[model samples]
Every structure is written in C-alpha cells, then in structure tokens.
Target: MTIEQSPAPSDVADVYDGIGQIYGSAWGPNYHYGYWDDADDTSSIEVATDRLTDMMISGLDVRPGQRVLDVGCGIGHPALRLVRTGDVDVVGISVSHVQVAQANELAAAAGLAEKAKFQFTDAMDMPFPDGSFDAAWAFESMWHMPDRGQVLSEIARVLRPGGHLAIVDVIERGPVSPEGRKVLDHVCENYAVKSLGTVDEYRTALAANGFVDVEIRDISDNCNRTLAVMADAVETKYDELAALVGEEQATSLLAFMRLSAVTPEQGYLYLAAVRA
Candidate 1:
C-alpha cells in the first residue's frame, strides 16, 4: 500500500536477490526489451533479445582480445554472448551480490569464466581504472542510476579514447500528461528505478562527459511488445509471485506491468557514442 520515496542500491539489490531467479525464469536471461520486426513476427523473446544484443555489439565495434565493460550486467548472459561472438574479454558489474554470484556460476558452466567475469559493483562508482576498457555496454540499466551524468562520466573515464558506449534503455519520449505521468511513476517505483530520462537528456549527458558522434534511435514500437509479454507472464504466475513478494506488492507490480504495456509516453531507445 505504501511505496518508498527513493530506493537505495541495497534496496534494489535486495529485490533482485529475492526474485532474480524467478524473474529470469519468467523473462529469460535477457532482461531488456525485445525487437519485433512486424505485427505478424513470431520470433521468440529470447531470439529477439539476442538480436538486440547483437545490435549493441555492432554499435560498440569491439574486436577480439579487447576488454569491454558490461555495466549493470544482469546475470552476465549478454556478456557471455558478446565474448562468444567477438572472442573478447568482458567484465560485468552489478549492484546485486546474488546476480554477481549467479552470473559467475553461469559463466563457469558455459566455460567462459576466463572470458567473461561478473562482480558486485555499482555503476555510479565503478571499480575500474581510467582507460581500462576498450568499450562499454549498458543494457536497460541507466534508469536506476540516481545521477545519470555521473554514471556516464564514470563510463567515459574507464573507456579508452575513441571507444564506443552502446546503451539500450527505457526513456521518456517527451512531456507526459498527468495520467501518463502516474503510470510512469508507478512503473519506476515498482522496478527500482530512480527516474527515467529523455533521449535528448541522455545525448546531452554523453556529450557533456566527452562523448562525441552520439546516436539516438527510438525503438519504442519494436520493444513495446516485451511489456505485454511480461505482463501476461506475470498474470499466469500471479500466485507464485505473490508468494515470493507479498500479495500487495505482486498486485501492484502486475498493475504497473499492464499499464507499461499500453502506455505511449514511456518508450525505449538505443543510444551510442564514441569517447572524444
């Protein structure tokens, strides 16, 4: 019935620690949105999410033996895919200790412990040296950052000159009406996100942090179907989710998921920039 005004890193981590596996089972390894090509496209969510990952990897322009930072990496599945595709080394960081441990286990099971490793680290204050990585990837992670600019600056600092940063994030399209704002607020609160930023705002922050050749692509239409799929999954698993988290929280989460599925004001975007 009552929502926390602002959730801290620990709060977010706790939520993931409790429901990470269940969430992964319902949504699969890739937690981000899926890309749908057409109304009749019947590709599975896993395939579409992999397509999005491939798109991000292409935007990054990474090569073999390069070190890439996977910011806010969820369960390290995307990082594993990147290493497999490009033969690159990836260091994934997450706020949740459970995620880091689970990701490491998954990496070991896939025989990628040497190529892809995950650690419990905050994106706002990453534990990496300057120019340590050749490229960076942030997938659906920026919205949880309390200070988006600070996080961007940290990513820029860790990346080498000319290194690319590719991000696929949920964004606010523009000014939202009161009704829309209510839906957005509920979604943010339920998802442990501090706030949503506009595509322009993301571009400006990247530029301010010494990033150039910024690119922003609105992919709302392609990704909106993910929310609908997620909502249906939640509805089917309502009892299980309620048992994990309280009934009130589960009901509220289902409401937010359904609203997010149909809301036009909340959108998705793909952004890329090169370190200047």
Candidate 2:
C-alpha cells in the first residue's frame, strides 16, 4: 500500500496542534503507554513510560554515534533519552508541525541540538534516504498511520541491513463482540487511528518487508494502566480540558479514555525485528 504525498488527514494534524500541550501535560512526554513491572506498582506516568522507552531501547541494542529514527516522535522526549542513555544520534519525525517545532526547541534547550533533531515528516513516506538509520522505533504511533504495512516498509527501507526496529503499539486481540466493537470504534475515532491490527498481522508484515528475527511479546496487562491514569488525569483537569478543546471534545475524549481503559479485547504489544 502506497500512501500519497498529500498532507496527512486533518484529524491527525489537528489533534496534536490543538490540544498537544494539554494532552502532554496529562499524558506526559512519552505520549504512549507505560509498562509496570508489578501489578501493584504505583509509579508516576513519567516513570512508567520511561520504563517502556528503556525496554524499546534495549531491544534496539544501539551503540554510541549510531543513527536512530524515531517514528512519530512527540515532543522528542524519548529521543533525547536515547541520546543520553546510548549516546546515539536521533532523527525524530512527526506529522504535527507543532510537535516538530516543540521537539526541536526542547532538544536545543537540553543541549542536544546536534545529537537529537526533529522534522515534520510522515511515517508512511519518510523524507530520509534508504538505509539511513541503524535503528528505528515507533512507540504507539503505528495505529495512527493510514497503512501499517506501508509504514513498516518505509521503516525497513530507511534502516541499514541488520538494523533493528522496535515498536510498542495497540493491537486487537481478536474479533470483538458487538459491545467491544463499540468501544473500539469510539477509541479509534477520537484517537485519529485508522484501525488496530493483530499481532500475527504485524509479524507477517515484518517478514514480508525483509525483516528477520521478529519477536512479539504481549505486554497488554502491564501497559493497560496508562489508559486508567489518563482517565484520572482527564477528570482532574476536566474544566481545563473543556476550556482548551471545548466541552464536547473534552467529554468525548474523557469517555474514550475511560472506556478504553476497561476494554479487554483491545490490548498492547511490543515487537522487535531486524532488517535483513
């Protein structure tokens, strides 16, 4: 599936440009789910998300000075963490111009301007040349892309032979019941996601794209707390969110978050594959 070079869907851009700051304030810099080691763990969202980031980085096994690409990098926090932890140079890309600008500014302020750079680019049609990166990671970003296969293909194309790709994304476990589908639909619509694919689908796409050593680990239980935390954050900032994005949007967003937290059929997964 080839995605045209036209601008991304307005929902994708608008969601970020409009309430990105507010969302970031609630969701933290990772903008993704957290991985808890223990079921009873009561860590902050930032700490838990950092744990998830560290897991992805470990899977990538990057080295100093190696170039890494961050697909759908929001606010560049995870990319900056990679620079500090692995001494890797990172190029982060996002469809949201607001995020791109903010990410670059954050990188500069953190004294990582040379090490971590961000650009307004799409995952389905990245701007970089083939074999440009040693490693790449998409943290909960693939669901928003119009075509997961095309996005994975692009990731494979930009990665050097033997380069690794690590991803943490929401996945559909199986055919959902009618009630489950309703909740799934609401989450997708509000989140600007096209659809959630299955674990087997992801494995097949990776293999078809010339990626090897594919490993998928279901970490849904560990990551499910992210939605719960987000729901609480929304409630805590209910009026502020309503003021920022209007009452209807805020209400819908909160409902989506709360419902998604309890929906068991929709889950999360961590996948790692190597460009062959």
Segments in model 1 whose C-alpha atoms lie over 4 Å from true places? 1-6
lDDT of each: 0.87, 0.86
State the lDDT at 130 in candidate 2.
93
Q: Write the residue-wise lDDT of candidate 2 on 1-276 in tens digits.
A: 122332355678887776656777777778888889878898888899999999999999999999999999999999999999999999999888888998999999999999999998878887799999999999988888888899999999999999999999998876687877887777676667778878988988998899999999999889987888888875777788899879998888888777877888789999998999
Error of 1 at 116 (Å): 0.6
Model 2 residue 41 lDDT score: 92
C-alpha lDDT (0 to 100) for residue 22 of candidate 1: 63
Q: What is the lDDT of candidate 1?
A: 0.87
For model 2, the stretches where C-alpha displacement exceeds 4 angstroms are 1-9
| Candidate 1 residue pairs that clash | none
Residue 228: error of model 2 in Å?
A: 0.9
Worst 10 residues of 1 by lDDT: 1-10
